[model samples]
Target: MLKVLNAGNETLYNNVSFNIKGQEIYANSLILICAAPYFEEIFVESSTNFNQTYNDIEPDSFRVFLRWLYGESLSQAMQNYEKEENRDIFFQICKDLLLASSKFNISTIKELIEYKLVTYIHDDLVYDNLEKVIELANEYELDDLFKYCEGLKDVIKDEADEPENSNIRVTKNNSRPSIINNLKLRFFKFRFFLKTRTEPGHKFKVIN
Candidate 1:
């Protein structure tokens, strides 16, 4: 697959361009169809001759996922995502990646991301972040994390719970800002460079 991507011969015929937030990605329909049923549907359903593109997707997220589809490691795809400045949107980006993975039937990537989400939530367990955790738990249907949150909720219920110990038993999330809530327009932008090489028939061939 990487050979064809590098050689660019196989990508020439019947390719589609995905328009993501003004950035374009040209991919082979057959390969994408074999990998993801959703892509098959997208190609089969298109009624135009200009090729199909999904404008709703985030370009950076798609680029990371597209790199993974070609042979890059998920960890590499997530490396920039783990930066301190991007931490607040990490889970949100993960969630977006998860959605894309699910759409593309990328099980390995999906499972790894799900595990990361669980670990992040676990590490963030506390009263000040309970509601944020709970909201994400519910959004992702994270049963174990929700149970942990419930246990902490019970601590606040019991009058015997110490007021001095706000460690894990911190107050509800309403008192503090949520990471998701604080995510602004800039946080959603996962900027990355896309290498391009011009090919025949006006096709935008991917080089890296």
Candidate 2:
């Protein structure tokens, strides 16, 4: 038998146990759908289903959905999923998560989106995702993301204008001393040179 509890401060699953497919499982919420052998048990604060259609049915999709419902961070949602060799699903999940996060008022998830998009600025593929990133940043008033995009724009323009085989090097040039100091040093050097050049026969007394 499956037992469920509503939102409350008490720990519902403490020492309470059940059997799923002959394996002992203890959780807060258990949804045992008819004709389904596996049990879906999850511990969450709140959950709701939207009428939106999903193209790909990946775990990340469900994770993002949960994040949107609970206002959880992107990092927390990603932690719930197991790591996969191909991250295509993960990337799409991140994009969807950002959209959902922005739709709601999830500040931490929005921050994660900004961090990821800003890091992509140094990549050549950033141009492909530039529009979406810029739109999100602008909508959320992300100053750092906007600045990073501006810097990437300048870099792309510079690279386009520069010729191949042209090595651009940056060097620091030291400037001379002030004109007044230079004149003072020159006068002092001239006086020293004149005194040293003159012999004892033509003795000259130095005056300040």
lDDT of 1 by residue, 123-188 (tens): 444555557657766775656445655754564455235464344222214333432232211122
Backbone clash pairs for candidate 1 read: 127-170
CA shift of 72, model 1, Å:
3.1
How well does model 1 score by local distance difference test?
0.53
Q: Whole-model lDDT, candidate 2?
A: 0.41
Local distance difference test, per candidate? 0.53, 0.41
Candidate number with greatest TM-score: 1
Task: Report how far residue 63 has shifted in candidate 2, in Å.
Answer: 0.8
Off by over 4 Å in 2: 1-59, 64-88, 121-126, 165-208
Model 1: lowest-lDDT 10 consecutive positions: 190-199
Look at candidate 1 and tell me the lDDT of residue 170.
Answer: 26
